[model samples]
Target chain A: MVYELYYWPGIQGRGEFVRLALEEGGAKYIDIALKPENRGGGVPAMNKFLEGPRVPHPPFAPPFLKVGKQLIGQTSNILLYLGGPLKLAPRDEAGKLWVHQLQLTVADLVVEAHDTHHPIAAGLYYKDQKAAAKRRAEDFREHRIPKFFNYFEKVLTRNRTAGPWLVGRRVTYADLSLAQVVAGIRYAFPKASTKALRKHPRLMKLHDAVFERPRIKRYAESGRRLAFNNDDLFRNYPELDG
Target chain B: MVYELYYWPGIQGRGEFVRLALEEGGAKYIDIALKPENRGGGVPAMNKFLEGPRVPHPPFAPPFLKVGKQLIGQTSNILLYLGGPLKLAPRDEAGKLWVHQLQLTVADLVVEAHDTHHPIAAGLYYKDQKAAAKRRAEDFREHRIPKFFNYFEKVLTRNRTAGPWLVGRRVTYADLSLAQVVAGIRYAFPKASTKALRKHPRLMKLHDAVFERPRIKRYAESGRRLAFNNDDLFRNYPELDG
Candidate 1:
């Protein structure tokens, strides 16, 4: 059965991490919220999942995946579960744990990225919290971007077996996650990411390498890989960037 | 061998979650940074782990537990690992996963709690970002607190077993973590939590039950349990709470 992925339709958001893995692995899946009849052409299905009582273990929010009877939420947990089946994770327990750790870190970075635009409240409009968002964006660009990017770069450099992939020779979920992060940063803060990439050669190479992968290339060009915009985590706010 | 816990000495911070589990289970462990000759104390140890030579899998941040040679970080991951040996988690996979999901939700709340104070940057002083922090804190108190508390309340209400524990008929990490969250909320937003508790009877019952547990009672009474202060995740700011 195809995995049912439930997330916001338009932007890649957190769901993109899961989507990339499924896309690159060529897994059979359906982006449920994007479908018309399934969701009644809106986010009601996603809302129903959140408010519904049928799920014994209900997800707190979206970007959740349904595999058979099991419903898994939390972006990192979803990736961890899919990693083995999709061949996006290492075989060994230690390596698998490492991949999960990397994914969790990526999740952390993603949260920080989102906070750059909506520091005050997720429910509030960006215009309502512009001042706070501006301050948060500055901190993100100055501290968080460098801190997270440098850490990933170090991991890439430190990996003795594979210089590019986060864990081993295989392209695990971490690799796909890194690629998306790089792409988001470039779209959001072109100048900062360009300057940051110079210090992290291996990370830059990995970002370039992921795009060259046949499946990933197809996914990127298929229009399914949504472009980063002001609506997503990596918003290109000129004032926030500098 | 005793488990090695590495976190800053003063505040309960994130390390408190691990500390509570260890205390309840009566696990043999040492809070590394609290001891003398600890090689420049907790801050140094934390920074070293973060900025030091890259391990095969680097932890994003501290509150990591070292059992033998394996170094595990991330609060939920550490709790999940310790939960088994400490008898703080369910033996069954499904139960374990549920508890983990609950713990991850707790981690999310903890992040939001931290953001209330340090909305702009972890590196910046709270005073420097007080304006932004005020707005962020308002949203947290008004929106996040109720959202998280209500979700957990529903989980407690939905448990068919009628058990106080989140999973089965036993106290798992979720129960302990929930107790801590309750305590933190009470400290941080006494007025708000008092009002909110009226609507969440099951959660309050669980909190009351956890407080009566022998080990937890001892831990709370002992000088070891750090008091809630401005330094911790849940802090008192009258303006923010209102």
Candidate 2:
């Protein structure tokens, strides 16, 4: 069955996390919001599912995956649902929960990353909160990024059962997500990210290995892959990079 | 099995979310962090798991549950695991995912509520970033709270099968979490929360019902329930409320 992904078009945002999993999992899915409006797509199409009275389980936000009649929302929740079906997560109950726990941690880091640019308010433009953003970014660069990276690096180092993957010997959705986050941070904060990467060789190795995989490499080179821009979660503001 | 919960002492922070579930679920559990450190409890016991090399799966932060040898981290993840055994979640797969989706949304709202006072940095004192906190609190009061409350209210109103609960007719972990968040927000932003609650009667009903439940009410008045203070996630800052 083909899965339908509903998210805002143009920017990667949270939806990109689902997209990475879908690509690596090799699931048959359509990016619903990217299609033209006449063919039942775009933000209007996405909003219909959200606002329509017929939907019993309406999502709080996008990055939701629609499998048949089921609509799964929240990036981590969507990944959890798709993990087993796509063979991207462990078959055991305990392993799946561990991978999901790691994903949630990544989600937290992502929120902090986004907040660096919009420290005062998500509704307000970055320019309006530029001063506050600068302060937030400084703390994020100096503290948060290293703290998160160090945790992941330790997790990787402590994985005796698995050679390099987060959970087991095989790659999981968490690995793909960490790779994406690392790439995004590098783009957003080149100097700081580079410094942090030097301290986290294991994490860097996992990030590099994830992209080198055939399925992921093809997706990365594919025209469908969106470029990192100011509109996305990870923006290139040199001043914020410290 | 007697489950052990580890978290920071003296605050009803994220740990309270887990405590509410454990209490309502009628599970036998120990509040390890609140226990005497001499008996393998308190912050030292909790830190041992975090910093120990023997732990295969280390949680990034607390509100972690130790069941036998397995440790589950992330508040939502812990609830997701306990939801089934304690009968706080739906048995069916679709229903479980839906409830979890709702829980994740509640988690997002909790983060924003905490950020009202720590918009600049979590590590920095609120007094240092009072100016930025004021700006962030304004947007949270005017935009974020209403958006989240409206979404939950709509979810409650649209839950045809479940009636008033977030999911099915039976109380789920999401409902308990929502109730906690609503109470926290009321403490943090009295004026804004009151205004938002006025518009969402359905949500307030759910919140009230959750606290009014026999087990929850017993726990509420058992003297174990911690008071909301400045040290907690939801602080009562009069200046930030407006």
lDDT of 1 by residue, B1-242 (tens): 69989887788988999998998898889888887755655567656676778555567788787778778877877887787889998887556667877887888888888898888888888889898888787787788888998898888867778678777788988898888888888888788888888888888989988879998889889888888899778888776676
Model 2 misplaced regions, further than 4 Å: none
Shift in Å, residue A220, candidate 1: 1.5
Go through the candidates in order and give each one's C-alpha lDDT.
0.83, 0.93
Which ten residues in a row are the worst by lDDT in model 2 chain B? B159-168
lDDT of 2 at A23: 92
Q: State how far residue B197 of model 1 sits from its true place (Å).
A: 1.8
| Candidate 1, residue A242: how far the Cα is off, in Å | 0.7
User: For residue B133, what is the lDDT in candidate 1?
Assistant: 83
DockQ each candidate and list the results: 0.59, 0.88
Query: Model 2, A17-122: lDDT tens per residue?
Result: 9999999989888999999999988899999988998788899889898998999999999999989988999999999999999999999999999999999888
Task: Give RMSD (Å) of candidate 2 vs. truth.
Answer: 0.9
Tens-digit lDDT track of model 2 for B133-164: 99999999989998999899889888877456
TM-score against native, each model? 0.94, 0.99
